[model samples]
Target: MFELLKQPWHWAVSGTLIGLIVPLLLILGNKKFGISSSFRHICASCFPGNVKFFKYEWKKEIWNLFFVGGIIIGAFIATVFLTDPANSIRIAPDTAGILNSYGITDFSSLMPVQLFNWSNLFSIKGLVFFVIGGFLVGFGTRYAGGCTSGHSIMGLANLQKASLIATLFFMAGGFFSTNILIPLIFKYLQ
Candidate 1:
């Protein structure tokens, strides 16, 4: 069982599990599912008197906070205990070659140390990528009414048209960032 837990499961396994979540949540009378809403719940619980947005009965969604907490704890356990260093960050040769062209040589960790390390956080590239990018993501998620997981998974499962539009834009934005923005950043900034 321990060895099985340590091994990587097939993509289908995760897909099936995620597929089941929609129906399970529906049966349980829960309409929403995502990490973003947990932030709202936390704010509502902590700052009930501060903002009109945070005046709701956050206790109703307390389970979502626990769910997000579990995700963080699980990630820590996976990275620190379960991960085999040799198999940490596997990339295809072509993908590695492409990244190498962008001055991203290190692939020893989940993300490129050249990009994600603490030292890079103080640099101009990191300021744009992390600080500004993070704000945009937060603003986008709020403006869109939900995050990618909420829209792509739960909202689409409920046949919401807005989710479909949001998902399409999300894909397009990802493509633009990967193909256009990232190369520009690497070429000019690095």
Candidate 2:
């Protein structure tokens, strides 16, 4: 079971499952689905501020909050408790060699790698990066008015041109970050 979960096929299956979600949401009376919106809905409920931008009747019971929470909890369980291969795609030996040159010798060691190292979750540098990354992600989700899943799936499902553009930009950013930025930073780390 663990080995089965590690295959790229598992990721493909997961992606297919996610691809179904947007259609399901649309069929269910067009729920305004998106992770970014869910975050806003939560903030508005908590703060209940009077600012023009932050104005919303956030007093309603946010079912989406529960849904988002479920997704998060499910992810943790899948990674930690579930026996699986963890969807790790190995780098080529040459690529890994270059990475080692830049200071990331056991690169995969930085992450769960095997999904059992709960201690790595609290390492000093790991904690710093996690907190900062969480903050940036939160801020970006709010600023973008939706997260990747929301925009790419629900928004695009509804034929939103804006969502299409945002998703394209998102892919471009990811490509640049992984191909260009990751190598440059790894160089400095060494």
**Whole-model lDDT values for every prediction:** 0.83, 0.67
Worst 10 residues of 1 by lDDT: 25-34
* Per-residue lDDT of candidate 2, residues 1-190 (tens digit): 7665544455578788888877676677566666666767766767757766557665553767876898899978866755344445566799778756654555453253432345646664344346655677788767776778778887787788988988898788779866897676546533
Query: Clashing residue pairs in candidate 1, if any?
Result: none
- Displacement of residue 54 (Cα, Å) in model 2 is 2.5
| Cα-based lDDT at residue 51, candidate 1 | 84
Best by TM-score: 1
Q: How much is 101 displaced in model 2, in angstroms? A: 4.0
Could you report the Cα RMSD, in angstroms, for every candidate shown?
2.3, 4.4
- In model 2, what is the error at residue 19, expressed in angstroms? 1.4
**lDDT (C-alpha) at residue 102 in model 2:** 55
Instruction: Report the backbone clash tally of model 1.
Output: 0
